[model samples]
Target: MHKSQEKIPFWRVKKLNQMNSEEWESLCDGCGKCCLEKLEDLNTEKISYTNIGCELLDVDKCRCKNYAKRDHYVPDCVRLSSANISSLKWMPSTCAYKLLSEGKNLPNWHPLVSGNTDSVHEAGMSIRGRAIAADDAGDYEDHIVQWPK
Candidate 1:
């Protein structure tokens, strides 16, 4: 924790919009939990996270299969914007977007802070092997995963 060992830049000390591209991209913890399909109840407006993930999500790495054309493949796929981060409700509790928007610092396990992208999976913050691709799971109702964590 000494000043000499602190590699995090001052930009990381700023808010989400104040960060440069490198800092911004590093904020994504690569948990892949956000990539999972969520269904919202029309009446209650509550969202339910299914075990189903997008076809592009890599089951092992918990990253996108197609990062560039994801918007084309899934038209509704939200490209995180400065405007949207604060209101994104379904983002995992450990998500960087939710954290920054709430005026909190990134957790120690975050890839950006830890300097290792795989730290997410190591800390069990990533969905990883738990996610089943939507292509494999036909019925969503049957695949609802109520994660106790």
Candidate 2:
């Protein structure tokens, strides 16, 4: 197809809020770092990532077990939306939503760019096989890791 006739990707053509539900959902790279529990320093407001996966996260698949009902199961779960994306200071640097909202393009490992969902895992960006279930994790402090940042 001619360059003018080629269809641009939705993410390139529309803002986050203008995307449909499916388009918005597809932007997630499925790295699972977002599902990991985090700790915050009250005095300095520093955020620390942990290898402990949320109760609703499927550690192996790196996806939520019940995404539609995650809010119901985890009352404290922070839902990422166009409205709140800017204020989420703790969101991982590799997060697609964060990147796009910051006027950056998606990384090559992003599923949308790679055309393969496993690319994120293959790039060693996903928490698959690395995260422990929340129930099995003894202490959040002990699981603190720097990779997610």
Candidate 3:
């Protein structure tokens, strides 16, 4: 009889704060929703996602054009980490960080669970090919969308 190997699920076993740098980084599902511009209502404190992507976002690849220097280019860009996870209320509900922080499991489309990097795009979760570049976008209010929710 052939021996069967047990697979260990890292996310289930490890707390978000316990993850190493690589593991923490890998938790990102590459959905690119975080790269989209958001508008906050001053009165209601509600955040709305816009289809107009950040200047550094590569819409097709759903990756940043300059990952290393993103903060330098976009001073307001919020860096997501375990410590600041709770403050990311504007992040997409489908975002892996938000899910994990809420003690929920990763979606099937997440690369860590799907074992394929393109699974997020295949699941129609990524902003790829759908978002307009911030430079080309006219009005933020006009570009508001409900998909990122």
TM-score of each: 0.88, 0.95, 0.92
List the RMSD of every prediction in angstroms: 2.3, 1.1, 2.0
Q: In angstroms, how far off is 26's CA in candidate 2?
A: 0.8
Q: Candidate 3: what lDDT?
A: 0.90
Per-residue accuracy of model 3 over 1-149 as CA lDDT, tens digit each: 33455666788889899999889889999999999999999999999999988989988888999999999999999998889987978888999889989999998889988899999999899998789888899878998899987
User: Which of candidates 1 and 2 reaches a greater lDDT?
Assistant: 2
Q: Whole-model Cα lDDT per candidate? A: 0.80, 0.93, 0.90
lDDT of 1 by residue, 2-101 (tens): 9889776653567778877877787788988888888888999988888888778887778898898999988988899778977887777788878778
Cα lDDT of model 1 overall? 0.80
Candidate 3 backbone overlaps, count: 0
Taking the tens digit of each residue's C-alpha lDDT, what string does model 2 give over 1-149? 88999988999999999999999999999999988999999999998899999999999999999999888999999999999998998889999999999999999999999999999999999998789999999967899998987
What alpha-carbon RMSD in Å does predicted model 1 have with respect to the real structure? 2.3
lDDT of predicted model 2 = 0.93
